[model samples]
Target: VVYQRIGNIPGVRSASIVSGRNFFSGSGSSYGLGFVLLDSFEERDADSLSSEAITQKMFMRTAGIADAKIIFFTPPSVPGFGASDGFEVRLLDRTARDIRDLDQVATEFSGVLSQRPEISYANNSFSTTFPQLMMEVNIPKAKEAGVPVSDILSAMQGYIGGFYAADFSRFGKQFRVFVQSKPEDREEADDLNSIFVRNTQGEMAPISEFVSLERTYGPQTIGRFNLFNNVTLNGGAAPGYSSGDAIRAIQEEAEKLPADYDIAFSGITREEIASAGQAGIIFALSILFVYFFLAAQYESYVLPLAVLLSLPIGVAGAYASISLMGLENNIYFQIALIMLLGLLAKNAILIVEFARQRRQHGLSITEAAVEGARVRLRPILMTSFAFILGLLPLALANGVGAVGNRSIGTGAVGGLLVGTVIGVFVIPVLFIVFQYLQEKVSSKPAVIHSNETKPNV
Candidate 1:
């Protein structure tokens, strides 16, 4: 039914459903429909995209479904990794000892996510509910009848495997067992019930008469993370929505959760959170490294300060470009920013280092600063444009990792061009200001050379 309904949708080239029997093979406990989208499918205003959107919107309309999910898949399966392009919401039950209450809470949370328009296919991990027949040992009754509970269990194991009776010596090995039952006769549950067990009276009694089987629905598998039972709510972002926006929506819905329920994200969403935390550390480390390196190269702390001043403009330009391109401030974007930090520092270094050399050569402060900026302009532009052009292919390329490629390429282009253009004017002023400070703090006079006529910068 699921496959047929999804197959009916316009963009779906084909839809195949895997049953719980096949899907929940002990290690995993989830079943879903895999969709193959048409080649012509496009996310914006296309027939395939429209069809997929409508299908997900109306998914809950199906009868007898607790939760449903739809996501894109392209394979080269990675071990110990989830196979989802969409976000996965894990509901952790702290107080619940078993899956009973945990599953109920999971279902309720799934319902909340399903109601949100920004997310699609909000499904609980406990999707397959199968009837399990539990067997209880009637210990008191067995004692009264003079039949031990072990005897009853032994009888059951015998049906599956002949009960061990005694050891017989043969070929230097001892083995002994006797069992009576045809394979065909014990093929079904009814056949097992028909088998007899010996009571204290030494009389055969029907197995069904001693054991009671009650049918109840239970999850086929239990998933645990950090020793707490977990149920995942899986889904993809809606059209025109970023994964971050979808996650924020999920966080909003999490407010209504019961006290025992804790939330955790998985897959790319979890990686994103981890990356964001590390980004701050990476940024700090990059700045410290650049500042100290410049300090060492110039052999003075004050001149390095001037080099650092040019960094903000380049970083700002990078961010502005990303915003204009509608790219999220994801890990890829942050990584690009870190890389551009170096490039921006390089541009400032060229100007500041050149001007400091001119100052040492007995030029006036203005002449040195002007000469520094004017001379290095071509080299800075040349190198920056060369790099920008090199990244152009990455920005324009399509397919896997294209988003990340473009994010880095476009950011580099913006940061290099905008920062260099602005830094040319700004660095000279910063150089003069910082140089005056250097002159004031040190005992050296500003005029380092003899009475030579000043040449035009």
Candidate 2:
């Protein structure tokens, strides 16, 4: 019905809605709905609303739903980890209370979950209204009728749940027979009473005569997480919110949760928390290797220091750019920083290497520095400008994981701009300083031809 209404909206070529179970067939995905667009969202005029505004408006316009929230499932994972895409909180079932009380607690926590302005689509994994018929077998009555409890259960299964009868082959293929009652006969809750079992006297006896029946509605499915009954609450960060912010919101809610209730994150959020510093570790290791290689190449510690020290300029740029752009210091930005470590280091190395060569050729320290800076300025500008321009598209991209992409691109640009332009000025000065120290230590006051010495040796 909602889809039908949405389809009527102008510029909406088609609207599709898919539930998690319908799509995943109970595989790995959770319970939710996926709304898709068949045509690009079009704004009819300047006053026309944005897609998000229109979606929220239409959702509110559709009258009937008691509670409605517009939530965008976090965009699909690149590697396709097969599960519903949403922020999830696996609230492991509480042993401290029964399912009913546990449900009440979950409801309260759900309210807490939705309270965060940064969160949306807070919902539970459990679906109800599964009408269940509970039967209490009268053992004595069944025995007096010569029907065993097992026989009674089998009879009920055959009628209500379908039982395997036998297999028959036709056209060279065998098919299993499923025995069930006529549709009309078992159409209602009272129909189960009419089911019959064979007694010792070989007479058909209605199951109702020896069974007590109770009717109730319950969950359609029971889920266990890590060997404990659990209900997962699914949600995601609001637009323009990062997962880090979402995690904080989740943590705040968790901290206030009852001691008996435990919460664990799964999917993307789990990976984020678990691999928190792994990216930094990778970045640090990259720099370590870079330094090791540079040291081997220079065969002098002081020259390598000059090159590595110049990286601070680029690092400063990355930090400043992301902060100014309101981007997170996330994995993408960190990865870009590692790349910058190499990039800026190379810029520094170029100047340092040239200046050292000049010094080796007997040029004065300041002269060597000024000459190297003069020579490398043009090449530095060309390559860094090219790299910065190349990143423009990435920094401006908008869509799934666009946040990370923009962070990476923006950080790279900022770092490159600083490292190349300013580095042309700074690296040579660093080389001159470190090189002067090197020459001072190396040129050691001529062992005065040992004129005053070594006669004792």
Candidate 3:
């Protein structure tokens, strides 16, 4: 209703409303109850399917239509403690057609409101109505026996909730001194009555005389996180809309709500943080290793500098891919770009290393440069294809954590594909330039003659 009202205002494009079970704080039972009140079933359809069709499909899939309604709750909120006087639970055998039916039943008592239309009425009270036995012991009766209320309460607490006696210190560690009755003994009401509490006069009194017990159903405390009864509102944006844009719009709408309400960005946001952190660390290490490998492979630091120059081409391709794909340049993609640097440089290293070897063998720099790329082309292409194919499934994955996986996979593939293509050509050019400088400054080429050959003075 809030969304609908807001959407009807000027400049508003569209609005959707949704509600669901309060799973976070409800009874911890697996089959606890809850419901969702949507403005319209059609408007709130998750897959754009009609409510009746969705219901029918769910019933058919479960093979028990009658059992399906058993889990449904009608009025979302039931009476909790100190609020049960005017309320009564009504079981509905027939489905409610409109909001009036819900309101009529809900307002039968004062201060009662219909449950949000979105929740299942039948399932709403399972957690809230768990059977509990409440007892109030007569303190006056215990006083006649010279027993104090504190002693009785202490005895009960010790037996039911356990008491910490002292801490045992051993070696540099401290362990708790826990005391409690056995579980089986604690479960019996008779066991509770048998607990003895000492009074101010040092007289022992059994708990039974001081307290009365009653069994009834009631709700436990309702907890709130940042107040407005937090709940997960699950839905997707319309077709042709980006998830990020849709989420941003929803967040903006939520922010306009009263300050008492709080909404967290969970699910994808949580996964992105973890995956991005891991990917970043891995990428950083990979780059460091690659740098070391290159430095060790080439004895001349100047040659490694020429090879490292090809890294920027790969970064450009990675950033372009994320931008074109409409993906945020997030941690996963950043890490993937880092990984791409190594893979990108591998091709450059092959061509550059081979050219350097040829140059040292007394071949002219241009001839070595041309021959190195031609010789390494097949290996570079083969390796690039292998990496791309290997990442294809990851790039397309939609399962849990797939968003981060796809980000990394796509970024790496894009960078590697572009880098490999560029490196094959550009590294050779760089090698020629560096070799030209080496030739200009050197008086003699470092010839790799046979080990047995002697040099003339």
Candidate 4:
């Protein structure tokens, strides 16, 4: 309604509601399995390994393996897969009993993406892609070397990963006590072996003696949506062009690659959610402000209703303006409609308040209305024209924020132009009707006075 009102302004060229684009599979929740091309493995070597062999090795070395393949397939339209850029391998595992356990593995897997430069953004289903490995030794493993599990666990925990104990006050500041091995030692297998685990007999034993330490890839730390692994590559678009256009271009480029891989864009939902939330907030605030203003001005609840009746006339003008001006129904125009309510009601208040005062003076309904309109007409016109003239400059301004400002200014000016003219004429007619009803209700005789006659003396 607001857009229509402002659109009719003479200088408004075009107005529209613009929003960000959502790609086919850009959302983090989308599912799919993607294969990462390992530089260490040659194409011929990867192809030579049977799918079963690959699956078994991955399962034994890592955790569960879903599907394994050599060269991934893409849609028919995409070009060469065999010689295309190396791909990142991803698998979906949503049915695990503990989702967080699986998420831990997925988080660790994301680390692999940062290790490679050729790969782009690796999307995942798991909410937390970082994984932390925690190890608890079996009593049997500790006892075999005559060591207490607690002693070994404490020493390893402190030396390997840093154990935080308590804070120490130093130089008027508190510093935490964190004990851990240096970075280089933590990364070496030989250094890890040097860790000493005390035996129950009070003898120090090498960590490698009884407990087997295997550094295997953590569980599927990241999650996949719909049981599919998805990836997205962020690239630049032409200046002044929309993201949608860039996505379509990228999609076309993707088609030129081999059809062995499945790729898509999926960021639309986020954009929609943001736009809806913003619009909803503005709409809610606008309504609340209008109600508050009306309630405060007229002490009687019924008088506010009469003022609100003038709103439809303003709304009708707004609609006509938008249609005539060719603007979109957007947030800026909505704000204009809100402003129009106040302007329209201002005019109505002038007429209604005047008529009300005259009625209080014991004037008849028709006499009160005509006299009110005659007295208020000049002031209403003057105020309305003054607002319109002030807004004209804003509507004509140019540059960075000019378009948005003009949209609002133009909408309000158009509505005010129409509303002020109609309000003056319509409010008087409405006041007359309402005043008559009020007077009739208040002037009724009391039942106890029916037969009583009192002389003037």
lDDT of 4 by residue, 329-368 (tens): 5457777877787788788888888877776666766787
Highest TM-score against the true fold, candidate: 2
TM-score of each predicted structure versus truth: 0.74, 0.79, 0.45, 0.43
TM-score of model 4 (CA atoms): 0.43
Which pairs in model 2 have colliding backbones? none
Q: By descending TM-score, how would the candidates be arranged?
A: 2, 1, 3, 4
> Weakest 10 consecutive residues, lDDT, candidate 3?
81-90
Q: What are the per-residue Cα lDDT tens digits for candidate 3 across 2-97?
A: 333233332224433333334323333223332323344334434334332343333334344343222211221122311111112222213323
The predicted structure with the larger lDDT, 2 or 4, is 2
Ranking by lDDT: 1, 2, 3, 4
What is the alpha-carbon lDDT of model 4 when measured against the actual structure? Answer: 0.55
lDDT at 94, model 4: 28
**Candidate 1 residues 1-457, lDDT tens each?**
6655556554556655554433212333344444445434233345335444555534643544545443443331233345556676688888766677787777878787877888865766574365566777777877787777888888887775576677789899877767757789866668766778898889877776667767777877777877777886667767556778889999998888887788998766787666656777888888888889988987777878898888999989988997887666666777788888888888888998899888987787899999999999999999988999998987665545666888888788888888988999999999999888988888544444655768769
Q: How many backbone clashes does candidate 1 have?
A: 0
Residue 296 of model 2, lDDT score = 89
Q: What is the lDDT of residue 8 in candidate 4?
A: 42
Give Cα-based local distance difference scores for all models. Answer: 0.73, 0.72, 0.58, 0.55
